[model samples]
Target: MRLGSLAYEQIKERLLEGGYGPGQRLSAVELGAELGVSKQPVMEALRLLSADGLVTIIPQVGCEVARYELQEVQDFFALFASMEGTIAGLAATRCTKAGLRGLDAVSARIGHLASETDPVARSHHYRLLNREYHARIHALAGTAVVGEISHRMWDLSDFLINTSGADHPLHAALDARHDDHETIRKALWDRDAGTARREMELHILGTLSVMRPQQL
Candidate 1:
């Protein structure tokens, strides 16, 4: 990759990792210097992020991180829950034995990491495994549109999860999210489409219930 592409990836990771708080301004010059790149690539990257709704581009004021209102978060979660539930149901109907085995591997890794003593490390590991498991489910569904939408929603959710604070009190619910994954996997293995869908919805709704009140 060129320096521009590298700069783009670096900045994208920072935003995705929650380094920039919601509505925080991103200075292209400063960011470029920090990343040891020139302003041109930083500018291009900001444009891309702005297009993705991860940042706002003010004509004269430059770019700032995008912030979500309370209702927006709620709506996003509801939509995400619906999409994921449908995906899970479809996955149950479509998943092959090989796909099931892949999901099992992800679940096992998550189960092992769930017992970690460090909350931050545990959260990180949980998110990684969660993404893998869900991605596999989406792949099994074989719906391009659904997969694309789910990926976007997940990007937003990732922003929220990473920035929500060290002691945000949602950590407990996040810990329980793994258990929900286990239930979902079981339902899929049994080829119970309805159960899988309902379980997935409940899992997302539970996440919304836990995190909504604490959101800014």
Candidate 2:
């Protein structure tokens, strides 16, 4: 990979993993030291991440992790759920038998995560595994354009979920989240597009509840 791309991926990884908090200042010089590169590449990376809505770059103030208000987060997830529901519906109609098996494998891995003891580790791994589960659905959708658009949104979703100022986000509800996945999987296996779409929408909106444990 190119230097800029490498810097971009590493920085984005930290943001999604909660290595950086929402609105936390991101010093390019410090990051360059850690990445063993100059500030230039890091700045380029931040700029790209900014475009992805994971970072905020202000001309005079420098860079920071992107932050959104509570209402913004709510609005984002609502829009996100609708888009993902559409993709799930597409996946239901178009996925091959082999593709369905691959999805089952990923879902099983997520199920295993339910037994994990560490909340932080479980949340981190769940974020990754959950992405895989949805990415499999995106692949089954068979539309590169839709997949590309959905993926950009997914990146933002991760940044929001992991950086939502909640140390235990999705940590306490592993079983419920896993149960949501099972229902979606069964719907997909049955090739029930209507059920898949509705189930996926409900499952996604449920993310807000986990994010705010008070609701859980």
Candidate 3:
């Protein structure tokens, strides 16, 4: 990748990791000097981040991180739940034997790691397994448009996941989510498409319950 693209990825990672808070100004010259790069690459990176809604660019004031309100987070999750349900429903009918096997493997790994003593590492492992399982389902759905939307949602989800503190109820809710995934998998394995679809929708709604007033 070019220097600009490289800078873009690095800056994006920092933003996602909460290195900068909402509305914090990003000084291109300062950042460039700090990172040992030229201002041009930093400026290009800021523009890309702005395009992704991670930053806001003002002509005179330069760029600042975008602030997300509680309502905004809820709205994003609502949309994500709906889309994920649809994808899961479709995937139930479309997944091949190999696809189902892959999902099963991921779920098994998650189950194996559930007893780990380190909460942080356990959470990270669960997130990785969850991503792999969902990606497999999306691929099986065979809908390009759905896949594209899921990708965008996944990006936004990174922001939510990062901000959802370790104490969030969502952590406990994830156990229920694992069970739901297993239920959906069983339905798919049995070739019961309707059951699979209903299970997925319920699962998503169940997960949404954890994102309440405080955690938003």
Query: What's each prediction's TM-score?
Result: 0.91, 0.95, 0.81
Extract clashing residue pairs from model 2: none
Give the per-residue lDDT digits (tens) of candidate 1, residues 43-128: 98888777767888999888899888877877877888888999999999999999999999988888787467776666666666
Error of 1 at 154 (Å): 0.8
lDDT of each: 0.80, 0.89, 0.74
Q: lDDT by residue for model 3 over 6-82, one digit each (tens)?
A: 88888876765546767788999998987789999999999988877788899987888777787787777777777
**What C-alpha root-mean-square deviation, in Å, does candidate 1 show against the real structure?**
2.0
> Which model is ahead, 1 or 2, in terms of TM-score?
2
Error of 2 at 3 (Å): 1.3
Ranking by lDDT: 2, 1, 3
Error of 3 at 191 (Å): 3.0
The RMSD of every model to the true structure, in order and in angstroms, is 2.0, 1.7, 2.9
Candidate 3: residue 201 Cα off by (Å): 3.4
In terms of TM-score, the best-performing candidate is 2
